[model samples]
Target: MNDAPLLEVRHLTRHFDDVAAVEDVSFQIKPGEIWGFIGPNGAGKTTTMRICATLDLPTKGDVLVNGISVLANPDNARGKIGFMPDALGTYADTTIEEYLDFFARACGLRGDMLAKRIQSVAEFTELGHLMGRMMDSLSKGMSQRLCLAKTLLHDPQLLILDEPASGLDPRARVDFRELIRALANQGKAVLISSHILSELSETCDGVIVIEKGRLVREGKVESLASNVSKNELLNLRCLAKTSDVEIALAEHPGVLKVRESEGSFVIEFDGDEKDIADLLKTLVNKNLSPVEFHWHRIDLEELFLSFTEGTLS
Candidate 1:
């Protein structure tokens, strides 16, 4: 990836009359990186994405796609960015191949170039076999892949995906993640917005979280996890019941929070090298030694929930 930013949104604000849809959001996306633009519904994610995609004019502030100003030259900006909205439409009579061909022609591809682009995108999205399939006949997952294929027809440098995996199953979601990683590896700067924290952690390089129409946090996933839960607790499986284990660790100073999980107990603490040993010694004294113990890492869902203070829709 180059040192220069592929896309930059500076003080981008959008408002509907007196209501601020997006409030002075600023972020930079580097080449070959998948940046997760995340937030709950009505958090201004779609509004912000539309501005970046040149589909909506910002009430204030500016956006630059590959250094081209979106406001000053929207046509140029459109050429550099591909937008996949949450809802997509497909013509009932058109086949998958015909749909891609239509978009390619609209994007000004000609002759062999159009054919190659259509074929390439079809192959990339695993839609080669569905080329002749009518749009209405395709399943939800297949249609979503077709939507992505259509988005790639123009071969834009930056892609803005808004909840692209909404209706996809687990297997289809995995395929979608691989598709996104492939795009990033091919040096495309992608901005994906999704409420699914697990999906974002699996695909994105960094995350930008918005809340109440404002950017609340932005950084590496590991940074968020480390900041929220440091020296995470170990899940201890005790032979005793939950009530007995809770009583045994109640007075232990090394333990911070104790909660029951399934049939086991989860003990959290700021355990130093000696604190871990002390915790085990304390447990042994009560004749309630744990049969299994495993360290836990805080996931993106936990980190996001901790910071956002609510469910992401």
Candidate 2:
């Protein structure tokens, strides 16, 4: 793959009347890379992505898909991008096969090329078995798969997936993540948005965080993890029962704060590797009998909340 960016958002701004939904946001996605577009609701993520997908016009700046200007030449840019939106338009009385065929023709595909693309995406999304089923009768998971299959019909180099993993079950989410990785391996660049930070953490190479219509941060996942959060997030669970885990953790001078979860305690520790090991031993000696003790350098949720004030524009 080329080192150049397949998708570039340069100083993009979008407004409706007097309110700016997006303000001076910019990011780049290189071929075979996955960049997560993340922000809370009303954070202009959808607006920014819409501009890149040629679904909305930018009030300022430009977006380039495969170096083609979407602002000036959307018709040509459309050929280079595949956009999977949050909702698939209701095609009443349309079968899965019929819906895909409609889009295949709309994409200017015909004859053997059209048939090949339809079958290819169907197989890729595992929609081949449900090809005869009505679109309206499909479950949320299947609908998401269908949305992706529609997006892939054009074989675009750049893919914009808006909340692609939202509402999906665990298995469906896992399959979607693998699908995204496979697409990137085939030399496609993806800009995906979702509220599920954990899923994005596992799949995205980097992220673009937008808040209140402004660009806040954009960098590699690990780079952001190290720079944005300095403290360690530890999850501690006991095999017997939830003990005075907080009191046991307090024995370690490295622990900063503690919060309770389902059956585990989330500890905020400003400790080194040795401090962590010492904390484990300290808990064991205290009769906490920990069954699971895990620690991670980053929490995308905390990183998100720390940067944004939950303000809506």
Candidate 3:
């Protein structure tokens, strides 16, 4: 991956009248990295993204796409970005194919070029069969797929998606995640915002979190979890007696504390994955039979609650 970011938001601050909708937010998206932008309803996620897309101006700072300032050269920057809003923005009487073709034309494609882009995005989004279908008739999941197809029509390097998986079913959300993964693997920089943290945790390489209008946290999911967590726990279930298990774990340097819970030993571990693995190895070396041993890491949902106060901006 390139050391330089394909999309960079530098000290961005946006004001609606006297109220700061987004305040001094900064982050960078390297090529091929899929990042999640998260916060409460009034946390200024949309405000920040709109400025990044060049649809809104910041009161202070700026957004850069491929090193072009979004504030100074919005048209040039826009060509390098694909921005998808929370709403589908479907037309009243447009078919899926019609919408794509129209946008392709607007993007300066003519004849074969227009036809090819329309076909390519449609196929990638799995909207080929539904090309003739009306946009208004799509399900929430299908509408999001169509919106994604539209966004990809320009083959932009950076993607800004807001709440794309909001109302999707389990299967649709999974499909959406796979699509995002595919995009990132193909070297697109993606910045997505959503309230569904579990899914975000599964899909994103890392996340940038904000509270109200200011940045609160930013990093990989596991890294952020470590920062917010007091300590990590290892849940070990054994066929052996709890006393035997505790005795076996006592010799390991990584085991901080061990308490019996039901049929398992909830061990407070003071190390990383390698240390955890070594602990398990040591227990087996002590001739203690083990059935289950795994770390209980903090997930994104818990991390989000820990990071932000659910207040509107």
Give the number of the best model, judged by lDDT: 2
Cα lDDT tens digits for candidate 1, 8-92: 9999999999889999999999989999988887999999999998889998899988889999999988988889999779598
True-structure lDDT of candidate 2: 0.88
lDDT at residue 186 of model 2 (Cα atoms): 98
- Report backbone clashes per prediction: 0, 0, 0
lDDT (0-100) at residue 70 of candidate 1? 92
What is the full ranking by TM-score, best candidate first? 1, 2, 3
Candidate RMSDs in order: 2.6, 3.9, 5.5
Query: Over the stretch 1-313, how does candidate 3's per-residue lDDT look in tens digits?
Result: 6768998889999889988888899999999999999888888999998888888888999988999999889999999999999997749999998999888888888988889999999999999999999888989989999999989998999999999999999999999999999999999999999877888998999999888799999998878877764566777887777788877788778777776769877677788878888888877877777888887666788688867743110
Model 3 ranges with Cα > 4 A deviation: 234-294, 309-313
Q: Give candidate 2 regions above 4 Å deviation.
A: 231-296, 309-313
- Give the TM-scores of the predictions, in the order they appear: 0.92, 0.84, 0.81
Query: What TM-score number comes out for model 3?
Result: 0.81
